[model samples]
Target: EYVTPGGYELEKILNRGSVAYTHVNEVWPNVYIGDETAKDKYNLKKLGITHILNAAEGTWNNVDTGAGYYTGMDIVYYGVVAEDITTFDLSQYFFSAAQFIEATLSNPQSKTNKTFN
Candidate 1:
Protein backbone atom coordinates (compact mmCIF):
# COMPACT_ATOMS: atom_id res chain seq x y z
CA GLU A 1 0.00 0.00 0.00
CA TYR A 2 1.18 3.55 -0.72
CA VAL A 3 0.23 6.61 1.27
CA THR A 4 0.57 10.07 -0.22
CA PRO A 5 2.59 12.41 1.95
CA GLY A 6 1.24 15.80 2.94
CA GLY A 7 2.70 19.04 1.56
CA TYR A 8 5.20 19.56 4.40
CA GLU A 9 6.22 15.93 4.43
CA LEU A 10 6.58 15.90 0.66
CA GLU A 11 8.72 19.01 0.79
CA LYS A 12 10.99 17.41 3.38
CA ILE A 13 11.27 14.21 1.34
CA LEU A 14 12.14 16.20 -1.81
CA ASN A 15 14.73 18.27 0.05
CA ARG A 16 16.41 15.10 1.34
CA GLY A 17 17.43 14.03 -2.12
CA SER A 18 20.40 15.77 -3.78
CA VAL A 19 20.92 14.46 -7.26
CA ALA A 20 23.20 16.51 -9.48
CA TYR A 21 21.51 17.87 -12.58
CA THR A 22 23.00 16.89 -15.90
CA HIS A 23 23.03 18.83 -19.17
CA VAL A 24 20.10 16.73 -20.37
CA ASN A 25 17.98 13.83 -19.20
CA GLU A 26 15.61 11.71 -21.31
CA VAL A 27 12.97 11.07 -18.68
CA TRP A 28 10.53 9.82 -21.33
CA PRO A 29 10.77 8.57 -24.87
CA ASN A 30 11.89 11.41 -27.19
CA VAL A 31 11.28 13.85 -24.39
CA TYR A 32 14.07 15.60 -22.50
CA ILE A 33 14.58 17.79 -19.47
CA GLY A 34 17.63 19.97 -19.46
CA ASP A 35 19.28 23.22 -18.47
CA GLU A 36 19.86 26.39 -20.50
CA THR A 37 23.20 25.22 -21.82
CA ALA A 38 21.55 22.33 -23.62
CA LYS A 39 20.20 24.78 -26.20
CA ASP A 40 23.50 24.90 -27.99
CA LYS A 41 23.19 24.10 -31.70
CA TYR A 42 25.97 21.54 -31.82
CA ASN A 43 24.62 19.79 -28.75
CA LEU A 44 21.06 19.80 -30.13
CA LYS A 45 22.32 18.36 -33.36
CA LYS A 46 24.22 15.75 -31.42
CA LEU A 47 21.11 14.97 -29.40
CA GLY A 48 18.81 14.99 -32.47
CA ILE A 49 16.47 17.34 -30.65
CA THR A 50 14.19 18.76 -33.33
CA HIS A 51 12.24 20.88 -30.91
CA ILE A 52 13.04 22.75 -27.72
CA LEU A 53 10.69 24.18 -25.11
CA ASN A 54 12.43 26.72 -22.94
CA ALA A 55 10.47 26.52 -19.68
CA ALA A 56 12.38 29.37 -18.11
CA GLU A 57 13.22 32.09 -20.56
CA GLY A 58 14.23 35.75 -20.78
CA THR A 59 17.16 37.36 -18.98
CA TRP A 60 15.56 36.71 -15.59
CA ASN A 61 17.27 33.32 -15.20
CA ASN A 62 20.31 34.37 -17.28
CA VAL A 63 18.84 32.44 -20.23
CA ASP A 64 18.30 34.99 -22.98
CA THR A 65 18.65 32.43 -25.75
CA GLY A 66 15.60 32.92 -27.91
CA ALA A 67 14.61 31.63 -31.35
CA GLY A 68 17.24 33.85 -32.94
CA TYR A 69 19.92 31.83 -31.24
CA TYR A 70 18.99 28.80 -33.30
CA THR A 71 18.94 30.67 -36.58
CA GLY A 72 20.77 28.22 -38.77
CA MET A 73 19.34 25.08 -37.17
CA ASP A 74 16.23 23.33 -38.39
CA ILE A 75 14.68 23.13 -34.96
CA VAL A 76 11.38 24.37 -33.59
CA TYR A 77 11.66 26.63 -30.53
CA TYR A 78 9.10 27.50 -27.89
CA GLY A 79 9.59 29.67 -24.83
CA VAL A 80 7.81 30.50 -21.61
CA VAL A 81 9.14 33.38 -19.57
CA ALA A 82 8.78 31.67 -16.22
CA GLU A 83 10.18 32.76 -12.90
CA ASP A 84 11.76 30.11 -10.76
CA ILE A 85 9.90 30.81 -7.54
CA THR A 86 7.32 29.07 -5.40
CA THR A 87 4.80 31.87 -5.72
CA PHE A 88 4.95 31.69 -9.51
CA ASP A 89 1.98 29.81 -10.97
CA LEU A 90 3.85 27.40 -13.21
CA SER A 91 0.78 25.26 -13.62
CA GLN A 92 -0.56 27.87 -16.03
CA TYR A 93 2.01 26.76 -18.58
CA PHE A 94 1.58 23.02 -18.14
CA PHE A 95 -0.81 22.57 -21.03
CA SER A 96 1.39 24.52 -23.43
CA ALA A 97 4.44 22.51 -22.41
CA ALA A 98 2.61 19.24 -22.88
CA GLN A 99 1.42 20.34 -26.29
CA PHE A 100 4.96 21.22 -27.33
CA ILE A 101 6.27 17.84 -26.18
CA GLU A 102 3.47 15.98 -27.90
CA ALA A 103 4.14 17.81 -31.17
CA THR A 104 7.86 17.16 -30.95
CA LEU A 105 7.63 13.46 -30.16
CA SER A 106 4.83 12.87 -32.62
CA ASN A 107 6.97 13.95 -35.54
CA PRO A 108 7.02 11.10 -38.00
CA GLN A 109 10.73 11.61 -38.61
CA SER A 110 11.79 11.82 -34.95
CA LYS A 111 12.11 8.11 -34.21
CA THR A 112 14.91 7.48 -36.71
CA ASN A 113 16.79 10.56 -35.51
CA LYS A 114 19.12 9.55 -32.70
CA THR A 115 21.60 11.90 -31.11
CA PHE A 116 22.75 13.14 -27.71
CA ASN A 117 22.55 16.38 -25.76
Candidate 2:
Protein backbone atom coordinates (compact mmCIF):
# COMPACT_ATOMS: atom_id res chain seq x y z
CA GLU A 1 0.00 0.00 0.00
CA TYR A 2 1.03 3.61 -0.55
CA VAL A 3 0.31 6.73 1.46
CA THR A 4 0.23 10.36 0.45
CA PRO A 5 1.03 13.30 2.70
CA GLY A 6 -0.89 16.49 2.24
CA GLY A 7 -1.37 19.95 3.79
CA TYR A 8 1.58 21.19 5.82
CA GLU A 9 3.69 18.14 5.30
CA LEU A 10 3.53 18.49 1.56
CA GLU A 11 4.07 22.24 1.66
CA LYS A 12 7.07 21.85 3.92
CA ILE A 13 8.57 19.23 1.67
CA LEU A 14 8.05 21.36 -1.42
CA ASN A 15 9.60 24.43 0.18
CA ARG A 16 13.18 23.37 -0.46
CA GLY A 17 14.93 26.71 -0.18
CA SER A 18 14.97 29.86 1.91
CA VAL A 19 16.41 32.18 -0.72
CA ALA A 20 13.89 34.14 -2.73
CA TYR A 21 13.71 33.24 -6.42
CA THR A 22 13.75 35.81 -9.17
CA HIS A 23 11.47 36.03 -12.20
CA VAL A 24 13.19 33.02 -13.74
CA ASN A 25 15.73 30.58 -12.41
CA GLU A 26 17.77 28.23 -14.57
CA VAL A 27 17.17 25.05 -12.61
CA TRP A 28 19.25 22.98 -14.97
CA PRO A 29 21.77 23.49 -17.78
CA ASN A 30 19.07 24.35 -20.26
CA VAL A 31 15.89 24.34 -18.19
CA TYR A 32 14.11 27.00 -16.20
CA ILE A 33 11.30 27.41 -13.70
CA GLY A 34 9.68 30.76 -13.22
CA ASP A 35 6.74 32.76 -11.98
CA GLU A 36 4.25 34.87 -13.94
CA THR A 37 6.87 37.46 -14.73
CA ALA A 38 8.63 35.04 -17.02
CA LYS A 39 5.65 35.07 -19.39
CA ASP A 40 6.78 38.37 -20.85
CA LYS A 41 8.06 38.06 -24.41
CA TYR A 42 11.07 40.29 -23.77
CA ASN A 43 12.14 38.25 -20.80
CA LEU A 44 11.81 34.99 -22.67
CA LYS A 45 13.80 36.36 -25.54
CA LYS A 46 16.49 37.73 -23.28
CA LEU A 47 16.91 34.33 -21.69
CA GLY A 48 17.15 32.58 -25.06
CA ILE A 49 14.31 30.28 -24.09
CA THR A 50 13.56 27.75 -26.81
CA HIS A 51 10.76 25.85 -25.09
CA ILE A 52 8.10 26.62 -22.50
CA LEU A 53 6.02 24.32 -20.32
CA ASN A 54 3.29 26.31 -18.70
CA ALA A 55 1.73 24.44 -15.79
CA ALA A 56 -0.85 27.16 -15.20
CA GLU A 57 -2.61 27.66 -18.50
CA GLY A 58 -5.85 29.48 -17.65
CA THR A 59 -5.41 30.76 -14.11
CA TRP A 60 -5.72 34.46 -13.36
CA ASN A 61 -3.29 34.78 -10.46
CA ASN A 62 -0.79 32.61 -12.30
CA VAL A 63 0.61 32.64 -15.85
CA ASP A 64 -1.75 33.48 -18.71
CA THR A 65 0.35 32.92 -21.84
CA GLY A 66 -0.86 30.12 -24.12
CA ALA A 67 0.43 28.49 -27.29
CA GLY A 68 -0.74 31.46 -29.36
CA TYR A 69 1.20 33.93 -27.23
CA TYR A 70 4.44 33.10 -28.99
CA THR A 71 3.14 33.93 -32.41
CA GLY A 72 6.36 35.43 -33.77
CA MET A 73 9.02 34.01 -31.50
CA ASP A 74 10.57 30.64 -32.21
CA ILE A 75 9.44 28.68 -29.20
CA VAL A 76 7.91 25.31 -28.43
CA TYR A 77 5.02 25.64 -25.99
CA TYR A 78 3.09 23.17 -23.84
CA GLY A 79 0.44 23.98 -21.28
CA VAL A 80 -1.74 22.21 -18.71
CA VAL A 81 -4.88 23.79 -17.32
CA ALA A 82 -3.86 23.36 -13.75
CA GLU A 83 -6.28 24.45 -11.02
CA ASP A 84 -5.26 26.58 -8.08
CA ILE A 85 -7.27 24.65 -5.55
CA THR A 86 -6.55 21.98 -2.98
CA THR A 87 -8.71 19.31 -4.62
CA PHE A 88 -7.54 19.93 -8.19
CA ASP A 89 -5.60 16.62 -8.30
CA LEU A 90 -2.58 17.87 -10.23
CA SER A 91 -0.83 14.52 -10.04
CA GLN A 92 -2.28 13.53 -13.41
CA TYR A 93 -0.11 16.08 -15.21
CA PHE A 94 3.14 15.38 -13.40
CA PHE A 95 4.37 12.81 -15.89
CA SER A 96 3.49 14.77 -19.03
CA ALA A 97 5.01 17.94 -17.68
CA ALA A 98 8.16 16.11 -16.73
CA GLN A 99 8.32 14.63 -20.20
CA PHE A 100 8.07 18.08 -21.75
CA ILE A 101 10.79 19.47 -19.55
CA GLU A 102 13.06 16.55 -20.29
CA ALA A 103 12.53 16.78 -24.02
CA THR A 104 13.09 20.52 -23.96
CA LEU A 105 16.43 20.10 -22.25
CA SER A 106 17.46 17.08 -24.25
CA ASN A 107 16.75 18.76 -27.55
CA PRO A 108 19.98 19.28 -29.50
CA GLN A 109 18.68 22.33 -31.30
CA SER A 110 17.93 24.12 -28.07
CA LYS A 111 18.87 27.80 -28.10
CA THR A 112 21.06 27.79 -25.01
CA ASN A 113 22.45 25.53 -22.30
CA LYS A 114 23.68 27.54 -19.33
CA THR A 115 22.28 28.08 -15.86
CA PHE A 116 22.88 31.44 -14.20
CA ASN A 117 22.53 29.99 -10.78
| Cα deviation of 111, candidate 1, in Å | 7.9
Model 2 clashing-pair count: 0
TM-score for each predicted model, relative to the true structure: 0.71, 0.72
lDDT of 2 at 18: 55
| Model 1, span 73-110: residue lDDT tens | 87778878877778988789889877777777777555
Q: Assess candidate 2 and give its TM-score to the true structure.
A: 0.72
Clashes of each: 3, 0
Over 20-106, each residue of candidate 2 has an lDDT whose tens digit, in order, gives 667776545666677754467888788788887776777463577777988888888887787777798878988987777677757
Question: Candidate 1, residue 36: CA error in Å?
Answer: 4.0
Which candidate leads in lDDT? 2
N/CA/C clash count, model 1: 3
Cα displacement (angstroms), candidate 2, residue 90, comes to 1.1
